[model samples]
Target: MMVAVDSTEKSCLSADGEDFFYFGYGSNLLRERLQIMNPSAVLVSVGCLKGYKLAFGLFKGQENHWGGGVATIFPSPEDDVWGIIWHLKAADRQSLDEQESVKHGIYSPIEVKVEQEDAGEVMCLTYQMNCFNYSLTSPLYKEVMCTGAKQNGLPAEYIKKLNAIRTNNYNEITPFTMQVRDILQHLQINTSE
Candidate 1:
């Protein structure tokens, strides 16, 4: 789907480009993966979205599969989630949609209110987890929450809450799981234990 860019951000671009704002929370939060996924994407800023928590959804099975947590859209009066925003050209969004599995309904876009670093506010299209395929069995789930905790300055209580999540005892490596492992290595956390 095409997202219309606000008139305010248009001047920042070089031409009459159809820009699409995407809010990324999971592995997409890691710049390396984003670079691999969309090399042309411009980093707009770091931002936050209220009323969601990251969790693994859109599952294929317990093994030889993976999924990532996305902001689950819901009504909340006092919750906010942090993430990165990217301004992508509409032409490149088709590949992103495919990478994100949009048509299969594994992901659906939503217009979210986001706080920009310098621009203040922007309406962006972001994806939410399918929820139908969520399971928290892997230790990587905790690793991801810990990564978010370290990167986003999330509260320790939040990390504790994340650690408390119930999963189905899964033992397969998803890309998301690999990401957490990478994050640990990046942080110089020993995995030898």
Candidate 2:
């Protein structure tokens, strides 16, 4: 249950003109990476998407790729999905989509309403996990999930919650992510449940 924190000016406007709100449930939560790519991007808020379960169902055949688990969007009235909301330009958003491989049957763009610190209600682009591209047996699964969970500066307690799950492994968790986590921890940014 990590909460999105804003570190920019008071006004919630996209300077690049094509600025849009992106719901980052996983990898896109990493601020260091995002800031490097899009300096104008700002974290807005966070909330749970109910009804979907996190699982690996998209890449059942690709063994060479990381065995990463994706957040599957399903009809769940009781389950709550946790994530962050980021505002970025259209071009930077494209970079995010490319990094996440959103078109690989792993993710699908959907419309969502996000809460902002000052503006309140706002429409944004949220992606649901593409169950079609999930891989259940990949070795880098857990680490990859953790990487995303921790990327938003989630607290250690929440990160521990994510680490508690060992259904899969993420041996391919990049060194860059590890470094980002370390730096975020040092900065004391909390993205926890």
Q: Write the per-residue lDDT of candidate 2 for residues 1-193, one digit (tens) a residue.
A: 2334443333333335466776665545555545655666677665455454544455444443444454445556665456667767666766666555676755666765555534455666666655365445343345544665665555566578667764555454566545655655644555442
Per-candidate Cα lDDT values, in order, are 0.58, 0.55
| Residues 37-122 of candidate 1: C-alpha lDDT, one tens digit per residue | 67666667766777765555443432323433333444466776667777787666766776667777666666777876555777
Task: Give the Cα RMSD of candidate 2.
Answer: 6.8
Q: Cα RMSDs of all predictions?
A: 6.3, 6.8
Error of 1 at 28 (Å): 1.2
Off by over 4 Å in 2: 1-17, 35-39, 63-65, 103-105, 115-121, 131-161, 170-193
Q: By summed lDDT, which 10 consecutive residues of candidate 2 come out lowest?
A: 6-15
Q: Which ten residues in a row have the lowest lDDT in candidate 1?
A: 7-16
